[model samples]
Target: MSARTSAPSWRPANSSGRSLWLAIAGLSPPAIGDSHTGLRLMGDVLSLARRRPFTSAVILLIVAVYVVEIAQSRPAFWLEGKGDLPDIAALGVVWTPAIGDGEWWRLITASSLHAGLLHIALNCYALVVIGGAAEARFRWWRTAVIFLVAAVGGNIAAAAIQPGAASLGASGGVMGLAGAVVVGAVWSGEGLARSQWVIGAIIATVAFGFINPGISNAAHIGGLIAGGAVSLPLGLTARLRRTQRPAPAPKTQARGTAPGRATATGMNPRQVEFQRRIDAAMAKARAEREEDARRASSGE
Candidate 1:
């Protein structure tokens, strides 16, 4: 009887091949593809972390603090604006009365705390944009100093202007970064068009604050002023130093001489010409003296 012939099976022939097939079918353990995807995501995060270490750390800290705030209070506190006042105060909101009682640390700490999800979200976004720019321009340490100084300045202004109200968020610091960028651009002679755009953005931001209720215009103003003040001398000194840099000495070449080439006599062209003139003068003087000596001998 003739043997019955069957078509070749599409199944993999080896265990490894079978495992790969099963993984593709979603029936096997976590596949290489999944691991690769995870690795790629981790690499991206690491790249971002390395690009701006201080900025990344600050953002992480803010988010972590917000998470702690959420854990300490009910969800309503972060989701809605109706959180308990005592709970908020405990979380380090800037209360003027508390400052009078010597909670002075709040001047800087309050900048890290937020009132709600929206508050933190807005502030964090601002930090990422403005703070990143400031960090790039002034470097991490200067950026840190600017942020802290602005935060303190803003809180102080708030305490002085609205002593009864409680305030929180990083708006002051963000505004300070914006201010520093503006001043830096101007000092670096970045041109009128760029400077105008930066100035316009600041004006628009301040205007928005004015139109919005419960926003601290005083803090914004104070931060802007403080940032500009801090950056002003730095900018001036940088400009002054740049201007004072000695001009490069002029390149000098020997007269009538081709660059990098010496005369046939192994002297520079200028030296050769000077020697020729000296020899000619000496020969003429010697000839005149000999003629005078001959004339004297004949007269004798």
Candidate 2:
């Protein structure tokens, strides 16, 4: 029937595939509440961007570069890949010989360049999930340092491994975020679930490289190691301090008093008043006892 066919038609052909990739990228909806509401999803995305300003800015820059490239008739799609990249080489892409010739800025700039929209989209999506989480955990400056180090490290490694070819894209930085998350979670004593998602993302990214011949596996590996290396000591120190710290002892109450009851010269006004009343009652009782003793001694 039309209804049966309509349901299948409404689904994107690669819906399942995209979902698997998203899960591997740590983009799955949080477990607490699942919703299909567009407005709520948009609001959450905005909130994440606000929390991670640097990450958001990086994503925006990549998108802007891609748009300009497209408008200028560069390789505009996945199918027409890598043809116009050389045209922008002087502008961003990393070439080893160029670095040797003193174009060191390429190490950082190349990471913001992409071969196509598909590449940029994947990296941005990964950034939103992984980078946002990293920023929230490590703060903006640390996250920025990690990303920059990982990106430059990845490019340098790629250049060394394949000096003749040029490398581009935020893949290295994205992988770095993954690596940082994995090691940071483990070192901070975060539970298995936290580490597993990041590990899964790394595996998924590596798998993508094997499937695509042009993808640079070297950059991914280099960035990952660099990120983990940078975050490990920081995470471990924090965990060590937490473990070594002493626990605070509980406050003890006066003997034979009910919970919430006050004592004399206590911190609270109510307790001070209660203590005064108890002191007066004790004094009167002591005086009466003395009078009784005196009477007995006098045989009155």
Top-TM-score candidate index: 2
User: Which residue pairs does candidate 1 place in steric collision?
Assistant: none
Which digits, one per residue and each the tens of the lDDT, describe model 1 over residues 63-161? 998888888866776775445566556777667788899999888877777766767766665665577777877778778888888878987887787
- As a TM-score, model 1 comes out at 0.64
TM-score, candidate 2, is 0.67
lDDT, candidate 2, residue 206?
79
**Residue-pair clashes, model 2:** 0
Reference-based lDDT, each prediction: 0.67, 0.69
> Number of the top candidate by lDDT?
2
